[model samples]
Target: MKFDFCTLLASSLQICYDACCTFRIWNLQVSILIFFSLFLFF
Candidate 1:
């Protein structure tokens, strides 16, 4: 039972990390676009 719980928790953490990484990448891309557009406008 303990081993099963640990395995489940580990897998959940891996999934969460992946999701966070994807969100971060998306945010970075958006920020870069905004930066470039602002620079051009200014």
Candidate 2:
């Protein structure tokens, strides 16, 4: 069965939200690595 436009939009929004969450976590991990690397250098 086919879905309506609203349902399609909701699915798209969910995908975008998931992608944003993933990116945020990735950014946090990278920052943590950089912080530790700086400490190691000093």
lDDT of 1 at 30: 53
Highest lDDT among the candidates is held by which one? 2
> In terms of TM-score, how similar is model 2 to the real structure?
0.49
Q: Give a tens-digit lDDT track for model 1, residues 1-42.
A: 254645655755565566567786655555555556546644
Go through the candidates in order and give each one's C-alpha lDDT. Answer: 0.58, 0.59
Model 1 local distance difference test score: 0.58
| lDDT, candidate 2, 1-42, per-residue tens | 675656755755565566557786655555555456546644
Give candidate 1 misplaced runs (Cα > 4 Å): 1-3, 24-42
- Which residue pairs show collisions in model 2? none
Position 16, candidate 2: lDDT: 54
